[model samples]
Target: MKINPLLVGLFLISPVFILLISYPGFSVVDSSEVFQVFKFTFHQALVSSLLATVFGALAGLSLSSIFDSKKYSFVESLYYAPSFVPVLFVVFSCLNIGNLWQISFKGFWGIVVIHVLINVGLVGALYSKILIHRLSLMNRLSLVQGLGVWRYLRKIVFAHTKKDLLFLFAVVFIFCFTSFSIPLIIGGVNSTTIELLIYEKLVVLGEVEQALSLALLQLLFLVFFLGLINFTQAKEKAITTSWNPFFKNKIFLLVPIFSFIVLFVGLWLSASFSLGWFTELALLPTLIKSLGLALFCGYSIFLFFQFIFSILPHSTFEFFMSVYSSPSTVLIGLALVVVSSVWWQGRWLVLLFGYVLLYVPVLFKMFVQNFLSSLKPALKVSRAMSANYWLRFKMITFPLSYSLCLFLGFLTAIWVLGDYALASLLLEADSTIALVAKNLLRSYRLDQASFVITIIIFCEFIIYLLYKGLAYVGGQKY
Candidate 1:
């Protein structure tokens, strides 16, 4: 019998589908509370997105003024560093920083501050590249016209990138809205987000019905925003030049840069002072387990997506695959927990399997194009030689992108290591370093949590180096 590729793919996500079908519906009494959560989530997300975008735009413009185009790539990476670091660590760092100022980073303002810090760098880095490229096109004509900086910015810079600015706002809004770790950590009872609400329903209240309802609502909201936004934008190449239009106003750029430096310093001081954390035996085992889980999840997600993308034709079916990746991590974790009795053994395997399921969509979105490009030449060679399916896959397909596979594995592994939402639902207290650190943070053991976060950062750097090393050895540019 022949099988449809879409049907086969659907079977993989049958768990989520089952949960949607089995939902007991939303309760009338809970409507007001649910609406309150929704309101809070929307308000915080809106404020955070607006602030991050403005500040990021300023930082981007500042960086463009001070740095040559040749240094833009380095600048981009430096700014984007915070986003890639573990969310838990970032939250912990912010909390430590707040403590120094006698500030309470535990409510609406706290949530906003952390979200801005985490996302500002991303917006700045991405916008800087585009702004700098536009800088090269300015030349002396625009300058000779005596177009004042503010007037130039208003008429030229902002006008030209309005669409991108809107897109950036939507992107940041979505990220902050669905944010898990930051809100989960610092968001007290009054400021709980929908994502955290879902976790509470499932983990604390055991309200599967309510959890499912909340999950569906969050999913619908995200899909609406995501549909309105375009995911794919043409990436403009970086223009390498020595020209600087805003050289006189470089002072403004230092604010965001200095802010980031202060946050890092606070995190460093917290970690460095916790010298006794190094002697804990529990830390070692926790690290090893987290490492093992990360490796397993990463390679599994890499291979799983590689196979699925290869088999599925790039059509509407491929687009449908990314839907599963959009839902909250806590939602997916809860769904798996509900259904684990039927098909899962309640072991770490369930967590591993769930990670692969959710992570595939993410990896698919990231690596699908790369996979297709790599396969084209190999498939051509195989077809010319009249190779069989197995032979083509074994000899040509896999070999061409082996380095990419390893690199993706490394990337996903790092992400899994730092993730707290999914692991929160599935793993035991001492199962992973992130979990342990989060628990410590919850218990107000700041010193111990800081040390754990430090180790996690150290592990991430090592993994990144390995990814680069593999790419170099395989003759692939990362």
Candidate 2:
């Protein structure tokens, strides 16, 4: 019997679609209030995306010179630290520093600052790679023609890197637009984004019609941004060649680079580390729960991806995969909450199912191209032999990508472990360590939360090594 791939894809996305279609009749109870929230969301996201892009460019350009001087490892902390550490830790660290300076990061400006701090390093790293990769040609042209700094920037830097700049802007914008955790934690009720509104309607007020209406509105924004991302990616591909190793002596760049490093380290130390908290003894349970959830999410999502890939046509697979990036986490989480409200007993199952739906597209986008390209020969051979789909995957595809899949699984698991927003709605505080940490912070248990965050960071480091080890072992064998 044949299966319809589109149907399968739709089935996979039914959770999100249900949220979209389940809207009751629209009632504009407070259209003005809702519109105000919409305006706030738009303004904050726009400003955050713009500032992040600019700061990222500065950091990236500065780091490029350092990389060229072969001091790349010296600033690896600044380059990679943001991603390795959980976001909440970063948020708390910033809040802590603000307190030290008597600054209140309690509203719109606070959200923007967190976003810029979080995204600046990413943008910088991107620029650093691009600059270093093309440094030789650029340097030669500028030096030979005696182009001044401004001219070189205008003629060479902006000309070649604008696509990258736009790409970064779009990505950061989407992130800010759909932001849930930062806004929820820092923005308070009045400063909530549309994504937060979705959560409020579902979890706080049980306003299903209003929630669905807002979700549809958010989806429209997502579709527009995703299209923008697609366009920018295509344009980037057309213009971009890839990055590193160029010799340019720009000492001025180091100032921004060092400043960025200092800012991050200061925040990290101030917020996440405190002496004498390790002996709390309750730390182990949180660690275990987080680890367990991560493992479950990582492996389940991977298995589901394999299942989907084996069944769907490539086009259909891509279409379904794109849908993954459509809804924000809060949106997806609330949808799951609504669905689970019906069965009541299997909310955990629905939560995990939601995890797969929400994150599979992410993992798919990350790994599919590399995995598919690598397994092409084996896949072709299996197809030529008329092997069944499962047989083909089992005999050919799985072996080739097992190590990679394991790595992806662990990565996904780490992300799940770090995640507080989605888990906030589904599981109790005790069930997910992230929730525990989040609550600890809210309850003014800063030292304890910091200790917990420190543990989470350590676990992330261990998982990172494990992921790299798997890749290394796979490299040798495969």
**TM-scores for all predictions:** 0.80, 0.80
Q: Write the per-residue lDDT of candidate 1 for residues 183-237, one digit (tens) a residue.
A: 8778887998998888888789878777777877787777666555545433333
What TM-score does prediction 2 earn? 0.80
Ten residues in sequence with the least summed lDDT for candidate 2: 234-243
Compared with the true structure, the alpha-carbon lDDT of candidate 1 equals: 0.71
Q: Write the per-residue lDDT of candidate 2 for residues 17-116, one digit (tens) a residue.
A: 7765655476443788778988999999999889978877877766666632436645644554564456787677777777777877779998998787
Query: In terms of TM-score, how similar is model 1 to the real structure?
Result: 0.80
User: lDDT scores for all predictions?
Assistant: 0.71, 0.69
Global Cα lDDT for candidate 2? 0.69
Poorly placed runs, candidate 2 (over 4 Å): 1-12, 20-29, 64-77, 129-149, 235-281, 301-324, 338-346, 360-410
Clashes of 2: 1
